[model samples]
Target chain A: MKANIIIRLKKNILDPQGKAVHHALSDMQFGDVEEVRIGRFVEMVFNHNNREQAEEETRKICDKLLANPIMEVYDYTIED
Target chain B: MKTAVIIFPGSNCDHDIYYAFKKVLGAQTDFIWHKESNLSSYDLVVLPGGFSYGDYLRSGAIARFSPVMKEVVKHAEKGGYVVGICNGFQILTESHLLPGALHKNVHRKFVCRDVYLRVENNRSVFTGLCREREVLSIPIAHGDGNYYCDEDTLRELEENAQILFRYSNEKGETDRRFNPNGSVANIAGVINKSGNVLGMMPHPERRVESLLKHDDGLKILKSLVNGISGN
Candidate 1:
């Protein structure tokens, strides 16, 4: 099974990198943006046929290694 | 005193720190590869700065899981001295050995310049020789050096005097303009509750050599050397 994870900075955490990108887009005449917050996307390949088990394991992985609870929150999905 | 400089794959300042320990401090120093697990032989272990693991995912995010980090944690649990500079600082935070995360600079630029740092807490073993509020000039080179922590941690850091250094003006005032990175409270360095582990974004090794004419970094190294002798 393959799993995809989205890791993002918490709403209160400052996103300087995202702000820079927003500014660049605005300079190029795409000025309709109110704000931008950057986050990370990660993929994982698990050796199992259990969709339920993979999703659970991916959450545990996010807690232990993939996401830093202090700075980020993560959500993931498992695909067949 | 025996010192070990932990050499992660992309660590470029390991040799510079080794030189400070060997030639400057006249201590027996060696490099320990990141794969090694035993860190019991050394009196001091330094995680020198560089783009460890190519700063993948995040700076120090991947390097934190290297085999040696397990030993590093054990070393810290025993109250052993560990200093992480720049990228090494990022790793320490990522490993949860330190209480914060380094985010990108507010300007989103890789800042490489000398900045003034004020010693906020000089009572720790790492800063024993330094005077509180004394400003020192140090070189900081990094893109993601803005330090952030939760509100409770910030309160505790303030109440306990755990903040080791803060970006400051030449006159030793913690002003906004002196903050090269947008770190909360303008923090440049911090020590854990035990005062055994230290992580800072400034490159102290870069200024250790006399030829560099910036000897502020030596004060920090010498303070640690002095602390070991006193202990």
Candidate 2:
């Protein structure tokens, strides 16, 4: 099974990197940029024979390693 | 005092901390490699500042899993003193030994300069020698020192008096610009709930000498020594 994990900073937290990108777009004369938020995209392949079990295990992985609970929120989807 | 400085592969400030202990406090210092698992004999273990593991992926992320940290955690649980500085602070947070996490600087730049830090708490083992609210000049150099924690955790820290240091102006007033990083509450350092483990963004080892000008860093180290020696 393959899993795709999307992790991003919580909305309440400031996204300085994204803000910097917003500024750079305006500076480069591309004024159409309205918003940009930076986030992490993680793709993983799991060898579990059961798809449901694989998704559960992947969620554990997300909680333990992929995202820090203090500042980030993550969601994962498994594909067979 | 018997002190050990944990040496990671890319730790550049290990020697600086070692020297500060040896010369300033006349401490018996040992260098423990990151791969070592034993740390029972040391009165204090220091995770010095540096670009540990080249700060790959995230600052101090990889270094937190080193074999030495297992022993460090055990020692801390046993009431042993632990101080993490700069990259060391990152490792402590990564290891879950301390609360919160360090994000990229607010300015998105690596800042390296002397700044004033006010002592928030002087009763802990880390800062017993300093007066409460006194400001001292210390140097900081890091790209990801912006501290972040949830509001509840921040309240817990404040209620428990775990906050140790806060950045301030020369006159000892809290200054947002002097904060350098957008740390919540301008917190520069904090002790663990148990109050034995300390993690701070500023480098006290860098300010232990008169030649460094304003050797106020010694006040904190002296407090540690007094705590260990029961002086």
Candidate 3:
């Protein structure tokens, strides 16, 4: 099984890197952009063949190490 | 007093802290590797600043899982003194030994310079020698030092007087103009609820010597020495 995870800062949290890129884009004549938020993507391979077990383990990994509950949220999908 | 400075891979400030405690303060100190698990004999355990694990996967994220961190947690839970400076502060937050998290600087730039810090709570073992509201000049060097926490956690920290230091002007005014990293409430340092663990972004170890033209950092180390001796 393989798990693909995407992590993002909470909606209310400020994303300074995204903001800087937004400003850079505006300066380059791309003025239509309203906002930009940055996030992280992670890919992991699990040896388990059970879809249910892989999903459960992926959730645990996200909660424990992949995403910080203080400022980030994460979601993932599992496929074999 | 005895001190142990834990050295994670890529920790560049470990020697500075060791010198501050051993050579400057005349306290016995040792460098503990990240894989060592026993910290039962030290009076103080320090986590120094640096780009640990290359600051990959977020600052302090990877270093928090080092084999020694389990013992660090056990040490703090037993009321042992622990101080996390800069990157060390990030590790404490990742380990959940301290509340809140450190985000990237608001300007998305690495900031390095001297900043004034107002001692918010002098009653902590980490600041017992300092006068309340006294402004100290310390150096902070990092890209991610902005501190953030939920409103409820902020309220609890305030109500419990857990805040140890706040960015401020030379006169001790905590205005937004003096906030170097956009930390919430201008918080530069905080103590855990039990008052045993301290996490701060500023590098007191870097400012401890008069050769550096600033000895303000000595007060923090001296206070810890006094606290341990008095205990």
What does chain B score (TM) in every candidate?
A: 0.98, 0.98, 0.99
Question: What is model 1's C-alpha RMSD?
Answer: 1.2
Choose the strongest candidate by TM-score. Answer: 3
lDDT of 3 by residue, B150-218 (tens): 999999999999999999999999999999988999999999999999999999998898989989999
Error of 3 at B99 (Å): 0.3
Off by over 4 Å in 1: none
lDDT of 1 at B180: 93
| Candidate 2 residue lDDT tens string, A1-80 | 89999999889888889999999999999899898789889999977668888888888887877777878899888888
Q: Candidate 2: where are CA atoms >4 Å away?
A: A47-49
Interface DockQ per candidate? 0.74, 0.61, 0.85
Give me the runs in candidate 3 sitting further than 4 Å from their true place.
none
Docking quality class, candidate 1: medium
TM-score of 2: 0.94
Reference contacts preserved by each model: 0.65, 0.47, 0.71
In model 1 chain B, the worst 10-residue window by lDDT is B205-214
Q: Higher DockQ: candidate 2 or 3?
A: 3
Arranged by TM-score with the best first, the candidates are 3, 1, 2
